[model samples]
Structure formats: structure tokens, C-alpha cells
Target: METKILPRILIGAPGSGSGKTTVVCGILQALINKGLNIVSFKCGPDYIDPMFHKEALGLESRNLDLFFNDKETINYLLAKNSKEADLAVIEGVMGYYDGLAGKSYEASSYDLARSTKTPSVLIIDCKGKSVSILAEIKGFMELESDSNIKAVILNRISPMIFEEIKKLIEETLPIEVLGFMPMIKECSLESRHLGLVTAQEVGNLETILDTLAKQVSESIDLDKLIRIAKTASKIEFIKPTIACGERVRIGVAKDKAFCFYYQDNLDLLSEFGAEICYFSPLEDKKLPENLQGLYFGGGYPELYLKELEKNDSMKQNIKDALSAGTPCMAECGGFMYLHEVVKDKLGHAYKMVGTIEGESFYADKLVRFGYIDMEAEKTNLLCEEGMHLKGHEFHYWDSTNSGDCFHAQKPLRKMNWKCVIGNENLYAGYPHVHFYSNIKSAERFVDICRKRKTKI
Candidate 1:
């Protein structure tokens, strides 16, 4: 199959808290409103911002992490998604320079930009610094000489400061000043201890997004921005390698509590003839009847512990499904939801599905973080016994006890800690695995689900 490449734009910041999220969200909404099918991508292991992007653009926003998958796969995913859209906009992680230690260049935004050959637009917070902003842009440009920095968007600036900073940046750097937006006095996105609140949690996210789009459209030079994005060099596309399979229906938990998912994962499942049905664990009375498989992605299950505890019938339903030999694959927050108990930061405990015999407690410090390379020590639905998968772990909770039913194994750590566990027909882990890293994991998972469905 021939690949199709689209005009692309990469939005990044100097570091965290530089208003990248707000700016990116606004950009996504504005472009989407222009009747362009805008496919979005988030740079690192983030679930929340992608949700907002999806909400803004009405498209499935995918993650592009160099740590989890090879460059070939990343290129394939970018090309695959680009086919369905007029343009693609990727939001970068932490600073453009921040990435894993040993694999710094691999996981950084610069890597993604280079691999995809996408032009980048730096969103610099011009709150206090005026003249120094040029130096920051120069440093970023020089840090990666091959990087195609098309433009700079000055954020959090007053009118006086915006003009001063804009003039200095254009005079000092060899890049165009795309636009600027003043720091607005509006109710911003809610955040938790980790980061911004998940899009599922925001009640009026549509209104918030509309407000954001209007703000960007009113503030930024939309025409110049589009032209800059169009100037990105187009690269040859690569089609995803889809394995042959019979059509299977999979029930995916997708609500405020369990919203972490990759667009590519879903696309892979679709490519393999699996029909995905999304159900909310928070609102759904029970799982879809006679579903072939259950996929519970990661989210802020800790925040809605009380509500989850109240849904005793739903908890029991999931426990019964697992006990009946239904294959299940769960990531960090989803893994916690299957445990016996999940305690919040306040030490209040809530009853979970009890499929996995463990109690998860919120710790003051981060337990596991960063990329991991895992070798499956035992057979499970997600991977064959000895198959290796690259993934990452980012969480604050620690499992103090795993009751007699479950066991953790094959611990791997580079910068963060990771472990896998199994109980009943379910395989759970702290490391958030993206199926793009190993398509075999998805195929194996669906195969187990098919077998379980036949038995039923």
C-alpha cells in the first residue's frame, strides 16, 4: 500500500508549565473548525492531554513515543493517521530537550520531529523575560541544528511585552514570530497532583474548547500559522503491518476513570478486524454482554475512588468476567482497579474488582517512572511466555501487598521500576505497554479473547 503524508506542525515549549497545553488545545480547535481533518499526536507517555486533543478536534489523538517503539513504527503510525486527515499536529513533551537518560535523543521531541521530518513551532512563555527570550530560542535551535523550527509563538504576554519580545525574537533568531496570546483571566483546566485534569472529568469541556478556539483565532495569525505548517517537508509514508484475523468485538473501558488509550492501538485492533465498543466503567451498569475481550486503559481511578467503590455491582461483574476465563489486559490505573483495594492520598480505602489480590496505596513519592524493557517470564493474554516488550511506568502508588491470588515477576528498571503480575485470567502491570511496540501482544491478547469466547 502506498503511504500518504500530510502537512505537519509540532508544538513544543521550553519546559513544563510553559502553557503548551493551552496553546496546543487552542490550535487544535481552531484548525479543526476550519473544516480540516486534524489528526493530533502527543509526544510522551501522557493520557490526559491527548484526551483534550481528541475532544477538541473530534478525532482520535495518538501518542508517538520513541522509547516504546522503533523509528520505523513511529513513521508508520504517523503515515497511517495522516491518510485520514488534511493535516497533523503533534504536541511535544516536557522541554524539547527532555527525554530518557541513556536514550535522550531517542525519546526527545527533537527525535520525533527528525524522524517524521516535521517542522516545529516553539511556544515560549513570555511572562517576565523579554530580551532573554531570543537567547532561549537560539539555544533551542542550536541544540539541534537539523531541527526545522519554522516559527515561535509567544505565550502569556501583555501587549507591551508581546511587541518587545516579538521584535527581539525576530531580530535575534532566524525564525518567524507566528503569533502571541495574553494570559487570560479565565477558569483554566483543572489539575491534580499529577497534571491537568483528564478531559473526561471536565463537565463542560466542549465550551472550554470553544472558548480556547476563539481565543486562539482572535489572537494568533491563523493564515501565517497554516502557511508555516504547510512548509513542512513531506516524507514517504509507511503502512502498518496488519495481521490477518477474524472480526472480534472488544469492550473498552473509556470514561473519566479509565480513559488512557492510544489511537494506534485501536487502529491496530481495527486493522485486525476487531470491533471496539467503548463503555464507561463509571456510568455503565455492566460490561457489554458476551464481549470477546475487556481492555481497561489507565486514568485517574484514584480521584474517583469513592464513586467506583459505590459501583459494587459493576465491580462484581468485572470480577465474575475474569473468573470465567475472559482474557484481560490492563495498564497502571486499570491494573489498580482490578486490585482488592485502592487507597487515595488521604488514606481512604475503596473496594475494587478484587480480581487481583492486592491493595494499592498512594505514596508521597513517585514509585516507578521512565522507560522499561520487559521480558515476559510467564504466559499471558498480552504476550507469549518469553516475549519482550518495551514500555514505560509513571505512577505514584505502591502495592504494599499482593494477596495469595496474584504474583509480581520479571521486574525491569532503567530510570523507573516496572513489574508484571497475573491472577485468574487477567494479566496486569505497572508498565504502560503500547501495542505498537509489539503487534504480537495485541494479536495474542485477541487470540485469548477468541478462545474464551468460544468456551463461553
Candidate 2:
């Protein structure tokens, strides 16, 4: 097996609000300021952290999710994205050990670290406590035999207190204290219903990132951080071979209204010889010309119903394109857009492209959330009979046309439910799929596009 030696560290927290993102943003910008190439990765399914990383370093961040992919795929993606980079900083999910139902380590940051053989630096929030912080850090360090936690970053601590805490921790425990942040309110990022607001929404993100870099560089020890990252073992895995079809053009909806897409999924589509032309459903008048297929991933379509409804040309064009036999894949919010109408909060109904014969009503609460292994109940646009694909669904809306072409089942259990709403040319559902889970799923879509290239 071939191996690649990449210096990396998984930045994790005891839990959410441990200042992990702030510290990560600081470290990323500091490294970038030193003229180093940094590849940023988010451990779980959350897309918001990666947005901050990209905003800080001007580089596209990627995600490594264990729920949607196996360890081999994780290593392949990590190595593929971190190639030739000076350092790889992986920002972890909620807590160090939180995953699935908060009882398993299936998709936790600890799982990511152990699977990829990368060391971790645990971030501890040291507010309103002193010696108890040591207990917190020590407990986390010794929780699992292979904790992968090599160092600690104390948040909301002064230099003098940090020195005392560092002295006590290093003396009593085998862990190293890397740095401490003195709780700067200006360094914080705001959040919303989904999570942190997308990086693009923060108008002064560049300025904020520069300030964070300065603060982190002043507080953290970059030399020790780099040394720890360099200690990561060489990763051994075979990168999956992607089968490419004849070149085909596909339209992808990407905008404020529809932006939840994995970087790997898009890259895999390109690797399979699909020219992905990105357009906006909220602003664009029509789909890209001469397209063989279309992809509309999960996003906040309900938030911009008025804008989407006002764009009559766009809605009619999309409906016409699908009717013309162009293969389409819509997930979550995208699925909502294909309905006759989408009723948002406050009981306002907005007209949508009536591809599916139903309406999507927002239900204030998550209809069905979490990981699932999808088995095609019947052959459709992206899969054949009994084809299994790993994905997850997290949406607040329900459609009257959740197609019965597939049955999505829990990974560690026997529970399953019929989903998706389409035939051989379309597959619309609430679940967001990661293409890396099954290469054939993407290849099949590309093949369909290739076959329909001449007719369109």
C-alpha cells in the first residue's frame, strides 16, 4: 500500500462553544501569514466551520464524515485534499466524542483522529473554574486508550493563570499545554437556526479573520503546534478509482438559497467527466444552456421564497427542463422547490416549479434527521434495484410526494422507510447524499447524462 506523510492535527473541543472555531480560524490565518499552504477540514457533517476556514485562509475547506463514508474513504479524502500542503487543520464536530445518538463514536472527531492516525489537541473552556479544569482535561485524555489527544488549548484564560494551569497540568499529567486565549468578545462569530451564518454573509469576515490571526498568533505556540502536527503517522489507503463517462454538462444550483453541498461530491462529479455549471434559483432567470442533467443539493430554499416566487422565468424553465427528460437530483430544500408550492413559516405560500405533484409545508421541527443507509426500492435516476447508498436527512419540511423508489434504513438498526419521489430520470428526496459513499451512484448519473447528451 502506498503512503503519504502529511503533518496534521484535529482541533477538538470538550463540547460546542469551547472556542474551537475561533482558535482554528486563528491558527489557520497565522499559518497562512507565514507563507504556508494550509488545507482545512471539518470532522463531521457540519458545513459552517469549513466556511469560516475558507474565509480565513482563502482556501476551500473539505469535510470528512464517518457516517457517510468508511475509514478508507476518509483517509483517501484527507490525503487527496492535504496533498503538498504545509499543514492540515481539521476542525472537529460538536464534542470530542459526540456522534449518532450522542452514545456512539461512529462519526465523532475522536473516530476521525483514530481512523486517520492523526494526533489531536483538545480545547478546554476554562471559564468560572480553576483546578477543576485539570480534572476536565485529564478525564478527556484518559477516556479512551487511543484518545489521540496530545495537547490542550485553554480558552478564556489569562497568561498568568495559563502559566499556572500549564505548570500543574504538565507536572501532574502527561499532556502538553499549547496555549490560551483571554476571552476576546470581538473574536466571536454569530449563529442562526442552521448554525453559524455562512461565511459569505459576514461582510467584514476578512477583517475579522485578520484580527483572529493576530490574537491566535500572540497566544498560541505555532512552533509546538507544527511539531505536534508533524508527528502524525503516514496514512495508507488506496484512493478510489473513478470511472468517467463521455463528457456531459450538468447544472448545479448554488446560491444563498441552495448551498449545502459537499466539496468531494462536486469534485467527484467533475472527475466523472461532468461539467458542473453552477447557477442560482433565486437570482438566475433560467438554467444553464445545453445541460444533460441537474443537481439541487440541500439548502435554505424556504428562507427566500419570495425571491424564488418572483423569478417566474426561472421556475418555468426548471419545470420545462425536467419535463424534457433531463435527469435531475434534488435533495431537501431542492426537493421542496420541485413541488407545486412551498408554504413557509407564517402560512405564506410561494409558487414553485410543479415538477412533483404536491406541496411542501414547513413543519417547525425536524421531520426525519440523522444517518441512513439508502436501498433503492426500485431502479431510478441514480441507482438500480436494491442499490445501497449512505446519506443523511435534516430538514424541517415534509413533502406530499416523498417518492417510494427507495427505502432509507438506519445504519445500526432494522428501521427503514420509503423515500424519494421520482422515476428513472429524476430522484428527489429530503436526504443529502455524499457521492463518495458509493462511486457507482455518481457514475450511473454521469452515464445517464452521457446517453442523453445528443437528444438534449
Candidate 3:
């Protein structure tokens, strides 16, 4: 097979608040306006960054998580999604060098750059210092044994200062100074417990993107960026085989409240002969008629407590459907919704479907966050007993009855706990799973749904 020539560049930062998202969104909007097909990607297990990409470019952004996904999967996704696009831009997760922990670069943005053989542009926040910034950039470049970093983008720096710094940086380091981006206070996105507030909450998204596009077009050099993206080496990938089976109708809960799902997860379901029927738990009166199973993904359900609670008919309908032997899978916010009550950040309790026992409380701090390996404590719709699944856990809430159906253990922290309620028909909990972690997980779910369809 001929190798695909992928023109890709990763936008990364020194640390978290280095204006990587702003710069990435700006560049995407600017490129799209120039009539270039742009496919975006996020480097980690982030759902919100991709949402922002969709809002900016109207193209569905995918993920390239090095933590759970292998090099082959990464190349396949990069090539598959970039087929017709002019260029693909992947925004980094954390710092360029930071990874799973302080020690290993297992799942860092740099790892994604190396794994995909893509070049990275490090964004530096030159807010309060000048010469000090150069030291930082030099450190980032030299610290990493293998240099995937090719360029530097200065953020929150004046044009005059950028020119001076650019000269100093170019003369000293063997990297290009892409451009400088001014701080746009008006275009700042809101932040919550789980990173930025989703695109759903941003009312003036288009307006913001337009502003960013205009600013980026004038400030940054798009032609240079395209050239940098094109510098990526040729890569080869073998497409993985999709599962084939009996067709089944799966009701997927999609909306502002349940929007945190991996794009691959849904793609795998469809490949397995699932006719996805998307219904809004926020707006829909009831579930889709005659569903073999239901999927409730993670999101900010607690934020819309009043609206979710007001829809009594839909809540009871879901509870009733579960009781009627319909297979159900819920995670985090979705899991919270299945409890007797869910508390808002303000500590106000709202009644929810009581399929699962106990009240889900919104704790101020993160509850068992980071990646983990989940072993099925017993047989479930997704996995068999003793089946191992790798996924991440990110939430600021906890349930009294998290269940003991699965045993979840985090590698670095050496932490372990019981989670999920699963059987041949149902699986629900706080851990947001990536279907690729265990392909059989999605396979089993679809198989269970197929059996449900047979009963009907």
C-alpha cells in the first residue's frame, strides 16, 4: 500500500494556560474562511476542545489519544479523517513534554507528535517577561531527547516585542517563529470543573470565531503555517476490520447534557449494524420507539438540573424502559441522572430517574480522576468477568452506590475501587470508556442488543 502524505501540525503549549486553544481556534477559523478543508484533532481524552473545533470550523474533530490508542490506530485515524481535507490540525493536551505523570511521556502531546510523526508548534505566553521566555523555549526544545517541535507561536505579546523576540529566538534556536497573537479578552471561553464550558453554553460562538478569524488572519501567516504542516513525514496505516452482526436499533442520548462521547465509539456501533437513533434527554419527551438498548454518555447534566427535572415524563420513561429489560449504558453525568437524585454545584437536589440506588452528590473536588484499568468484577453487557478495559475517569461528583460490578484500578496512583453495574443487559457508572480500549466491549453491547431485538 502506498503511504499517505499527511500535512499535519500539532499546536501545543508550555503548560495549560499558554493560549493554545485560542491560537488553534483562530488558525482553524482563518483557514476555513480561505476555503480550505480543515479537519481538526485533539491530542488527549478531551471532549470539549473538539467541540470548540466543530464550532469554529463546522468539521467534526476527532481524538488521537496515545494513552489507550496505539500508533497504528493513530495513523489510521489521521489518514482516514484527512482523506479529502486540505490540512489536519491537532491541538495538544497539556505541556509539550508533560505526559501521563511527571516522569513518563507516555500520553503527552509530544508523544502524539512522535507517534504520528507530526511536527509541533509550541505556544509561549510572553506576558510578563522577555529574555526569560527564550530560556523556557530553549529548555523545552533541549529537554526532550527527540525533537518533534519545529516552530514557536508567541501568545499575549505585542507586535514590536514579538519582532525583537523573534530575531533573538531565530538567531539562538534552530526553530521558526511562526507569529504572535494578541490577547482577545472579549473572546475568552468560560471555564468549569471539566475544562472549558461546552460549545452549547457559548451563545455567540460564530461571532467569537469570526473575531478570532479576523484577528488571526491579520496577525499570523497562514501560508507559512500550511508549509509547516506540510513538513510532516509520510505515514502508512492499515485500516482495522469492523464488526459485522445482526442489525439492532440503539437509542443514543445526545444533546447539550449528554454530548461527551468518542466519535469512534458511535462509528463502531454503526459498523456493528447499529441503527443509531439520537434523542435529546433535554428536549425529547421519551426514548425512541422499540430500542434494543440505550446509551447515555457523559456531560454536564447537573448544570441543567431544573430543565432535566421538569421533564418528568421522559425521566419516568427511561426508568420504565430500564425496568422492562432494555439494555442501558450510562457514564458520569448519565450515571448521575439514573440515580434517585442529582445535586447541582449549588447543592440543590433535583429528582431523577431512580433506576440506580442512592443520591449523586456534586463534590467540589475531582473524584478518582485520571486514567484507569477496569476489570469486570462480573459478567456484563460490555465485558465478561475478568475482562480488562482501559479508560479515563474525570468528574467532580460521586454516588453513594457506585456499584461493585467492576473493579477499577489506576496504575500510577496504585488506587483501586469498585464501580459500574453490569450484566448481560445493563452497564452504568462514572468511568467514561473508550470503546477501542476493549473492542469486545462494544461488540458485546451490540450482541446484547441483537438478542434484545430477537426477543422483540
Candidate 4:
């Protein structure tokens, strides 16, 4: 095992809606203005918040999920990704203590903080209450023995009584009051069914980031936050060994419609000798030439129904490629696009790639949302029979035939369901697979692509 001191801090909240994303983005923007090479991470399996960190703020962002990786792997990922960077700012998931099945803090932000030995700053929404805010901080600290809550940032608070609130909190509690963020109405991000409308959809995104950056510069204590971040303990872990193999080309669908992808997944594929060929499904008329494999990650394909349907050549090309036994992996929105028909929220119908035998429609509510444990029921492109993988599912659309190639069970719940249409050359499902959870599965995928390349 190797060891190195890593400068890092986690930005957490008492719960969701406490402006964690906004505050994290603001602080990130503020720090970027000072010319620091910052690497950001989002806790758990969220694919959108990291978009803001990477796309909107121009930082290298990745996901750190306790559920997907063990402590050693998590440490290795942090150390590996944080190389030559000034600081690592991790955005926490949900509440500080909320975790798997809402029963324990097994995979919460606290788990990430404690496991990585990274200090955290809690951002509490102080819109209505002032004195009681201290109580909430105290409660969070008291709830866990190793909460690692080093500082607090008050959100949506008035600047008039900032001094009084800071003094009261510092004098009464053990944590430091960094500063407060006044409510900025114009900088608020819009939302749809699947959390914040992706960073690409926000029209005034640059202006919003600029406004938040100004607020963070004037209000937040960046020096103190840096000091706390520097206090992170050294992490030790065995460096992961990714096998190198024959290079092969893999076409990946990437655009506003098909943009939900884990950066590490692509990185891992690259480490295994797969050359990524990125093509747009929204505007492109055909898939990239000489591709051995196809990967389509989750995004808002439903939003671009008309655009996708109008592009008959693209849809036909994808359908033909999949039909010709090209190894493909599609999840959620990608899976939705493979259907013969896709209906919009207003019940308008449109044509899609007819690889999957079904139609997809908006279900009006989140279906099977949260963490899931998947066991392959048969040999497939990425896994052998009985192979297990950790994944997450958060979607409102349901397909007429979701397939029965894998058995999925909710963690901490006895509920079991069938998902994923897996075979020798495909893995299409609603669940998003984190390749880190099962490295061999990803290696198998690369191997399949390599063999296809040689055959071609």
C-alpha cells in the first residue's frame, strides 16, 4: 500500500434543499477566480451535480460513492484523481447522515468523510430560524461520534444579523461559522422531474455562476476553508491495476440528450485500451465508422423526442448496428431511445431505434428510485451467470418490456424485480452500472470490443 497526504474537504448539508450545490458551485467558482487547480467530486451516484462542477465551472469532477467502492478503492480513487491538484472539493449527497435505506449511515456523506478522513463544512438553510440553527448543527454533531463537521455555512440568511448569528454559533458550539450566503433569486437553477435541468439547459448559467462567485468572494471565508481542507489526513491504499489490452474503437453517444455518463467509467475503459469515439445522436446522421462497441449512458432522451424522431437516418443506423450484433450497453435514457416508440409527457408519440421490443412512456413518478444490487441471471456481454454488480436507478419512464436478464433487489428491502436485457452483445436496462463496482465486468466489455475489432 502507498500513502500520501491529500488536501480535501467535503461540502455537506443537514439535508437536501440547503443550497449545497449552489454553495459548492459558488465556492468552486470563487476559488477558480483565484487561479487554483481544483478537482471536485460528488458523493453517491448523482450524474447532474458533477455536470455543473465540470461543464459550468470548468473543473475536473468525479463521483465518490461509498456504495460503489470500498474504503481502499475510494481512497485510491481520491488519491489518483487528486494528483497535482490544488484542492479536492467533494459535494455531499442528501443529508449528512442519510444513507442506505434510511436505516444507517453506511454510505452517506458522513461515511465518505470519515472513510477519507476529510473534514466537512455543513451548509444549513437559515431562511426562517436563527437561534434554532445552532440546535441543528449541535444535533448533527451529536448524532455521530465521528461526524467530522468542522465548520458551518449559513445559506439564505440576512447580512444584517450575520455577526450576531456567527458569534452565537461559535461561542455556543465547537464548530466555526465560516460565513453566510444571502438569498440570490436570479442565480437559482431551474428543475424538472429529474432534479435540476442539466447544466446545458440553463440559459443564464454563466451569469448565474458569476453572480454566485461574487457572493462567495464577498461573504465566504475561503482561507479558513482551505486551512480546514489542508488538515485532511494522509490516505493509504493499494494502487488499482487495470489490465492493458489490444486497442479497439468504441462509439459513445454524447449530446444534450444522451449526456449522463460517469467519467471514471470512460477512464477505466481508456485504461483498458478502448479508444472512445464520441458521436451525437441528436444531430448526427449515423454512428462513427469502424466502431467495435457502442455505449449510451442516461440522459433526457424524452425531451428530444421530435428531434430524434425526425432524424430517421440516425435511428435506422443505430438500429441496424445493434441488430448486426454490435456489442452495446444502454441505460435509462439510452434504453428508452432503443425502443420502437417513445411517448412524451403530453402523450405525443415518436419513432425511435427499434432494437428493444417495446415502447417507453412517462410514468408520472420515479420508478424504482435508489440503490440496487443486481445479479446476472445469464451470461451477457459484461458478466457471466450469477455475477453481481452495484448500480442505481432513478427514472420516471418505464418500458413495456424491461427484460429479465438480471434480477434486481433493493438494498435493505426484500423487493426483487427483473431488469436489464442482457445477451452476448448487449446490456440494456434502467439501472446505471458503475464499472468500478465490478472491474472484471468492464474488462470483459473491453475484451468483447477487442475481439470484435479483430474480427472486423
Candidate 5:
């Protein structure tokens, strides 16, 4: 792979709830207003923040997970997506230093910053301490000497105390104080049990984004920030290894219950000429007509168990399609929906699609969490036997029984409450696999669906 140079900026924070999302949204809009073709990304396993990025820039924002996606694929995705864009902005996960099991290899913002060789701008929450802010920035910079910390943006700073903090940071840290935003109460994003409220649920989002962009542009130094981003080192680009013959049309379940899809996955599908059509499992009677494949991403299926149970016909239609050998892929929440029954945290049970002969129950403890290198033990839609794919597993649900129905590889154990399943045509697991890491998986899935169409 040859090196490909592109301007990029990473927006991260000292920790979660530090107003990083607000800062990123403002920066994205500001860049877009400058007529720069901007592409955005989220560091960890999140589907909602990217949505806001998309709305702000009017271009789809993708995700890069050190846990669920491999290094090669991450490089390829950044290279491919950044081809026509003037700049790429990535939002970090949790704290900049937080990682999985205390290891920096997976789920860490620093891991992603290093992997892409992008320069980072720390967004520090300046509430009380003024002069001591320099120490915090120095600690983060020294913690990861390899990472490029170009600038710092102080968020939630009161105008009365802003000059003191800015002067201290400028006098001490080697980096520049790019800008700061006053503590605007209305500018904060709405939140729910999982994370930020889904982008769809927020009504006045456009007005909010526009206001945020205007405010940041008026306060921040855009020219210096752009120069800092341009100074970052470049990464090599790699072409996708997997290819397909014709466009494959896939039906995806996209309701309130199943919405946890990686934007990059959908973008890659489109690149391969796959037409994605969405259907509501909560209302639709059947899958989209003439669909070549079906994908069920993760979401809060447990919360809407009663509504899904009431949609008996849709559940039966999915079960019948699976029984007829349709190529279908289901992730964690999707996996739960395919089971015979799903019991919530309240112990309320509801009937689900019985495509898999098992029952899922919400557990008091998380069943599994962290990165996994999964190798196929048998050929399926995802990959051929022995091919490995990198992904992460995080769920609070556990299965009641294994049964002798589906087959998985060594690392996946039934007793450990990692994987459970139904038929060969149907795959449901806790680990969420980003398609870019294993393009062959999507190719194989589409191939199988096309073959099934030929038989019909």
C-alpha cells in the first residue's frame, strides 16, 4: 500500500460528558460553511453521533472502531471515504485514554488517533480551575507521546474566566489554545439510557446545529485549526479486496427496535452496488419484495418487546423466510429478536420470531464485553471456513439454552454466554462485525442471495 496524504482532525475530550459532541458538530458545520467537502467519523461503537455529523455536513459520517474493525480495514475506509473530501473530522469515544480492559489496542480514542496518524484537538471542560488546565493537557500529551496533540479547545468556559484559562494554557502547554465556547445551556444535546438521544428523536436538531456552527465560528480560530490539521502525518490507502458481479439489493430492519448499524457498512454496500432498502419489523408484514439479502442490526428490541410481540405476522414472515433458506444476518439486538422469546429487565416475556429455537433473557450483569478475533468454523454468508474477522461484543442479555441448532468457532462458547443460533442460513451473535473489516462477508452474503434468486 502506498501512502495517501489527507487533512484530518480528531476531536476528543478529557472524559465523557465534556461537550465534545457539541464542539465537533460546531466544527463540522463551520468547515462545511467554508465550502470544504468534509467527512466525519466516530471512534468507538456508536451509531447516533455519526447521524448528527451527517446532518451537520450533509454528507454521511462513518464509524472507525479499534475494537470491531481491523487496522487494514480502518485504513481502507478512511482512504476511500476521504478521497474527495477536503477534510475529515473524527469524534473520539469516552475519555481520550479509556480503553477496553485497560488495554489500548481496542475501544480507545488514542488507538484510533495513532492508527490513522491524525492530529488531535483536546476539548477540555473548564469549569472551576483556571491556571491548572495546563497540567491536565500536559498529562494527556505526555501519556501518549506518539499521538499528535496539536491544539486545545476549552468548552463550557464562562466569558469572565476565559482569558485567565486561555493565558495559562498558552503560557504553559506547547500546543495553542485554538478557542473556547461559553457555557450555553441550550446548546447541549439530549441524552437517554444508552447515550445521546437518537438523532431522529430530536426535532429542532437543524436549528441547533446551525446555531452551534455560527457560535463556534465566531469564537474559534478556524485558519490556525485548519493549518494544524494539515500538518498531521498521512496514512497509506488500500483498495477493497472483495468484489461482486452485480448490484445486490438488501432489506434491512430499521425501526425503533433495530437501528444500530455502522454507517460505513451501508456506504461499503453502496460502493459494491448493493441497494439497501429498509423495512420496519414493527409494522411491515414482510420483507421488501425482490430483496437479495437481509440485515438485522443491533438496537433496543428488548425495550419494545411488547410491540414486537403484537406484530405476529411480521415475525412469522421472517421465520418463514429463514426456513426457506434466505441469507440473513443478525447482530446482538437483532439476535434477540430472532429468538423464540425475549424477556426484558423487568422479566416481562414476549414472543419473537422463532427463527432460532431459543429464549433470551435480560441479565443483571453484562453477558460479554470487549474485542474478539472471530474465525469461521464453517462456510456461511460472512466468510469461508477459517477466515477471521475482528469485532466487539457488548450485551446484557443471555440465552437460556444452547440446543444443537447452529455451529460456531472455538472462542465462542455457549456456557460463556457469547453465541447462540438457529439455522445455517440465519446467523445471530452478540459480536457486532463491521463489514469493512471483512468485505468478503458481504460479498458472500450477496452471492448466496443471488444464487437463491436463480433457483427460484
Candidate 6:
């Protein structure tokens, strides 16, 4: 067992839209301004919020999901990423106690805090009530044996009553009232069908971040926050083992059209000896030379149909590679890009790679949205027959011929369905897989890439 003393604090909310992301970002930038080396983390499988941390603020942000990884891995990931940083800021998902299916606390933020032994700060939305706020905090603290909540931050409250509520809460509850954040209208982030629009889409992103940092520095107590973060104990974990095998070059599609990738997934591949070469299908004219494998993750392909269709050479490049038996793995939006045609919300069709015989169109609503456990019905690139894995599906698009290579069942629900189009060299489907859920699948993919490279 390995142990590391990590100074960390988790920002959790009673539920979503309590301004968790905005608060975390504000605190992160303010800390960075104070010459503190800060590393950020998101609790669950969100790919976008981490982008805000990485792209917008230029800080290294990683995901720590209890659903995809065990406690040991979570601790290892936290310790591994926070090695050179002064503080680690974790932003919780959905709600503090809300976890899988809204029934169990299996993968909740509280679960994560206990597993990693990190201190927590609860941020309550103080819009509608006053004295009732203390009841909410007390209930959360007593709901579980150990809530791990150390402090509180009130959001969307007026400055006039800040001290009034702060004093009342400190007098009533066992937790310390950190500070309050007044609603800054222009600094708020805009949302589309998915959560916040990608950090790149916001026109005034830099200005908004600057405004948030300035506001947070003035409103929030940085000294108290730092003191709480430093109180976190040491984390104990088992180091992961990796195979130092043959090296393989894999071309990964990364751009505005296809940017949904877990940093851990790519890191695991590299740890297993695959040199990832990133290329943009949106701008690149051709695939990288001598690629052993191709990976296209999920992103906003539907929004940029015209631009993707205009890149005729890149589409043909991908189609030709897939046809030649190059190993490939694609999820949600990436699966849509392989279709013969993709229709936007207005029903306008645009040509795509034509690897799949059907077209992808917006479903108007989320289809099969949640966590899923998958069992492969036949042998495929990443697994053998009857093998099981964990993944997630959160997309608003559907394909005309969504394949039936795997049987998927939603956790805690009686629903089961058929999906995926798996073969010896391809695993294209709507379910986004975290490689750590079953590291063997990741290792298998790396081995396949190595074999392909050897043949060439």
C-alpha cells in the first residue's frame, strides 16, 4: 500500500444547479492567482466540466467516479494527479447524497469523500428561504453516519442578508459558514441540451472567468477555505500495474466536433504502451501516417454537420482506414459520424464517412440516458463472448441501424436493450465506456493495436 498526504476539499451541493461549477471555477482561479498550484477534479463521468477546468482556466482537471473505479483506484488517481500540486479542488456531481438511480448512495459524492477521506464543504442554494436553511444543513449532516461536511457556502443570496444568515447558520448548525456568492448575471454560463456549452463555444469565456475570480475573491473567504483544505488526511492506495509491451501508434480524433474523451482512458492506453497521436477530423486532411488503431470519442458532431460534411478528404480517409481492418473504437457522437448521413434538428441531411449503412438524426429527447451494464453476445475486439462491462449512455441522437452486438441493462431498472456494432476490429456504439471499469478491455485494445502494428 502507498500513502500520500493530499490537501483537498470537495465542493458539494444539495442538488444540481446550485452553482457548484461556477463556485469551483471561481475558487480555482482565485487560488491560482494566489500562487498556489491547484489541481481540479470532477466527481462523476462528466466530460464537459473538466473542459471548463482545463481549457478555460488552464488547470489540469481529472474525473474520479466511484461507478467506474473502486476505492483503491480512486485514491491512487487522486494521489497520482495531486503529486506536485498544493491543493486539489473536487466538484461534486448531481447532489451530495444523490447517486445511482436516485435511490442508493453507491457512487454519490459523500461516498467519494469517505472513500478518499477528504473533507467536504456543502454549498446550499439560499434563494427561497431563510431560517429553513439550517434545517437542510442539519438533515444532510445527520442523514449518513459521517457526512464529512466541514463547512458551508451559500449561493444566489443577496449581500444585504449575508451576515444575518451566516451568523444564524453558525449558531444553529455544527458546521462553519464559509461565505456566500451573490448571483452575477453576466458571469453565468449558458446551457444547451447538454450541460454547459463546451468551454470553447462561449464567446466571452475569458471575461466571464475573470469576473468570477474577482467576485469570488471578494465574496468568499479564501483563508478559511485553504485552512479546511489543508485539514484533509493522507490517502492510502494500491498502485496499478501496467504491461510494458510493444509500442503502437493510435490516431485519436480530437477537435471541436469530437472532443469527449476521458483523460484516464488515454492515460491507461499510454500506460499499456500505445503512443496516442491526436488528429482533428474537422480540419485534418488525412489520418496520421502508419496508425495501428483509431479512436473517436463523443462530442457535438450534430451541431457542425456542415463543417464535417465539407471535409470530404478527412471523411474518406477514415472510411478507407476502417475498411482496411484498422482497429477502431467509437462512442456516441463518434458513432454518429460513421453513418452514411447525419441529419440535424431541422432534418437537413449531410454526407458522412458512410462506414455505417444508416443515418443519424436528433431524437428530440435523450435516448437511453443513464448508467448501463453491458454483456457482449459474441466475440469482439475488446472482449470475448458473454463478457460484462460498465458504461454510460447520454445522447440526444439515434441511428437508423443501431446494431445488436451487446445486450445492455440499466442499473436498478427492469429495462434491457440491444446495442453496439462490435467486430474483431471495431466497437462502435452509443454507450461511452470508461476504460478503468474493466482494465482488461483496455489491455485487449492495446494488444490488438500492437498486433496490427507488427503486421505492418
lDDT of 4: 0.90
Per candidate, the number of residue pairs that clash is 0, 2, 0, 0, 0, 0
TM-score of 2: 0.96
Pairs clashing within candidate 1: none
After superposition, candidate 4 runs with Cα above 4 Å error: 190-196
Q: What lDDT does model 3 reach?
A: 0.86
Model 1 agreement with the true structure over 166-229: per-residue lDDT tens digits: 7777877788997887786463542431264655556766787788789889878878887877
Local distance difference test, each candidate: 0.77, 0.86, 0.86, 0.90, 0.77, 0.89
For residues 1-456, what per-residue lDDT tens digits would candidate 4 score against the true structure?
899777899999989888788888889999999898899999999998887678788888999999989999899899888888889999999999999999979889999999999999999999999899989999999887899999999999999998999999999998998898999877765242126366766677888889999999999999999999999988898887888988889999999899999999999999999999999999999999999999999998988889999999999999888888899999999999999899998888898998988899899999989899899998998899999999999999998999999999998988889999989899999999999898988899999988887877
Q: For model 5, how does the per-residue alpha-carbon lDDT over 71-169 read when each residue is reduced to its tens digit?
A: 777887787778787888888988898887654445688888888888899999988767778888999989867867789999888877877878877
- In candidate 3, stretches whose alpha carbon ends up further than 4 angstroms from where it belongs are 190-196
Residue 111 error for model 6, in Å? 1.2
* lDDT (tens digit, per residue) of candidate 6 on 123-181: 88899879999999999999987789999999899999989999998888788988888
TM-score for all models, in order of appearance: 0.90, 0.96, 0.96, 0.97, 0.89, 0.97
Worst 10 residues of 1 by lDDT: 402-411
lDDT of 3 by residue, 76-148 (tens): 8788778788889999987887887566788899999988889888989999989998899999999876768
Residue pairs that clash (backbone atoms under 3 angstroms), model 2: 403-420, 403-421
Show model 6 residue runs off by greater than 4 Å. 190-196
Model 5 local distance difference test score: 0.77
